[model samples]
Target: MATTEMPNWFVTQFNKRAQHIYQAKGNRLKGTVAGADRIEANEAKWRLVGKGEAKEFQRGQAATPANTGRGIVGAPLKTFQFFDEVHDYDSDRAADPNGAQEKEKIFEQGGMALGRSADREIMNVLNTGAATAGNNFIDLGTTAFDAAAAMTMCQRLQAADVPWEGQVYCPLPSLLWNQLLSAKVVNSSDHVGQDLPFVKSTDTRFWNGVNWFLLSDSFFPVPAANKFDVFLYHKEAVGHAPHTELKTYWTWLNKFTCWEVNMLSKGANVLLQQEGIVRLRAPSNTAITLN
Candidate 1:
């Protein structure tokens, strides 16, 4: 029997394909927050400096320097890895020329796995931050999310001195997103003018100084049964430090008579500014039925 070996170019193609899929569908919040491509150590730090205010000067007043407070926020990166094995039998079947290749299927699944893991880590950090959000958390009780509720969230963030001029983002669950669509301010033709036209159900929209995006509830860490938290924040509020981008590799295992493909990444997500984030606690099971 002749043993077949995976070509070098084939491995390269597989790696590239896996990476492309990961980038396309991996983290839904990829660009919504601050990110770093590389870090020198296991931890990444972001510098925080207080703002300085200008004071009116008199013609003869002596010049005085004001001291601004400064601090650092750090997040430690952790490795995430996923792997799949393709046995010789499976590989033979995949090469039958009648169906999709086993490697292609593995690539797709591995890419999504890498992406979801990144999202899971980021959401876990957000959930932890929300628990200690202090005045930044809003418990909606049983009330479903709506345009008014969104406005209230905006008000709270603004009160915390969070900039709202095209800097705010709200990632809504499907249920809450549907509820928002029912609001007159969102669906009413009078309010849906050309400047901010309503787009498709899947597209992000801007309204009342906040950019709204719909995200799957699976990405969020539920605080309780039938309850979930929605995060409204500025891009600067959260930080993602990636020690390594998603990478793919494969090797033929002689002992197991199988080929193993692996995907991996290293990163950390942290809430950089408590004041810049607003957490909305809402019932997860409630939703608006469209006509």
Candidate 2:
């Protein structure tokens, strides 16, 4: 294992700067999905409880409820590393005493790199989970979303007996959101009666019983030109666990200094009851129109 002889304050600032950039990317999805179970790894094995069956009861008869089991699984905690090397003798810092600022900036960028890495992992689990949701996937065909279509989706969830109390999120692409706007189906308070200039937003809006979260185009998986995967799920439908937030190390040699940062997280997104999540194949991309 490698070690560092850096000062306590310097290490503290490094971690602080790293977490600032790292958390922004992490919280993008972490803050949204609701119920996630967590477990620590020992000897490279971990287990999470899977969803159990629920059945109707008889009024006056003996019954046997189905047995439940944990989803015994072993997924290595993912690690991401970012590093930079600075040559002490052949660098600007070699002559300037004020070069410490540049060094800190380099560390900050390293932190942001780790943050973006975490963002990819978050998206990975979400996309994979939604894709393999089996019967939970609802195909909207080539038709763009409208008020009636959105309401019918809610009814499907209701039929599945998914809890209706908490917020259900619908993560959709920006272009699909425009379809909603053009159809006059979505309008938030900020967009009400404001004469302000048209500024693009990736904000969430309330419509029907679901909160529609507009994500960047890159965040979605667009397998076809006219279709994109969108998920409408309760917090309980997905899970996320971070075994390690961010661990960093710095080392100095005779001529060059080395630095590295890493993070470990486990994904339990697809284990929840499929009824709580509904994947939709919606019309998307640049050519989308109401006609």
Candidate 3:
């Protein structure tokens, strides 16, 4: 078979494998936020409408029209791509018997690389949202995260009128998760009954009217040594726009005599509402050892 003539089945399988890995490893925040797909051009625009209050109406009174705020928010999509070159010798070697292991390596690596990049970009967007959260940003000083802190986070959102009945989420690092487990209110059955962290034996659980999920330490950016930020927000508070989903392409380079496999995606993560997001600054190095 010619280098350029890859069968349709091969292409389909390659894409399926890469996409599976990408979905499994990339963008832990995928469905947790709002999304706009098939975006036209580089920017995706979302329509924002402000809340309006009702006033007491007198009998036969003329309707009073108030201007409720509304605007267009745009998220700029950026391209993220990863490519690998397979030399003719490597391709020939892969075609040999007992060489099946090498064939899928490139696709796996490409998927993982692109997935990590997507997650990194999402984390950056969270940081940006946190920076601009204004009054919603909370600093816990150097103290560890506890049930009180979690309650405070939930209360802040509730006070701001952000719905908390299955709509709030707190994504934190394992360090903070450990500290939270140390809190008597989280691990003790007396405080939480069967829903206790230790009783549930799960990394993710619903507590204090928020769905808390644990993210790997690598995804979060370290502002300073042993310091990181935890984001608690409503799902509608953030937005993700995808100009293109993960795509893979293969091309034969005549001059280089190599096959270039390229994987890429285009998307943007943006803050949709400041009122619905709360950023908690906490120490990242704190953990509690279980007895």
TM, every model: 0.84, 0.71, 0.84
Residue lDDT tens for model 2, 71-140: 6444445666666665554445422445556556666677656655654565666567664445566677
Q: What is the lDDT of residue 24 in candidate 2?
A: 55
Q: Candidate 3 lDDT (Cα, whole model)?
A: 0.73
Ranking according to lDDT, highest score first: 1, 3, 2
**TM-score of candidate 3 against the unseen true structure:** 0.84
Q: Is candidate 1 or candidate 2 better by lDDT?
A: 1
Tell me the spans in candidate 3 whose CA falls farther than 4 Å from its real position: 1-3, 88-98, 131-135, 184-202, 254-257, 287-291
The candidate maximizing lDDT is 1
- What's the number of clashes in each of the models? 0, 2, 0
Candidate 3: worst 10 consecutive residues by lDDT?
Answer: 193-202
lDDT of 1 at 233: 86
- Spell out the clash pairs found in candidate 3: none
Model 1: CA > 4 A from native: 1-5, 56-65, 93-100, 131-134, 187-202, 289-291
- Model 1: weakest 10-residue lDDT segment is 193-202
Comparison by TM-score, 1 against 2, better one: 1
For model 1, residues 167-231, the per-residue Cα lDDT tens digits are 67777878888788777667655443233122332346677878787777787667788898888
lDDT of 3 at 118: 67
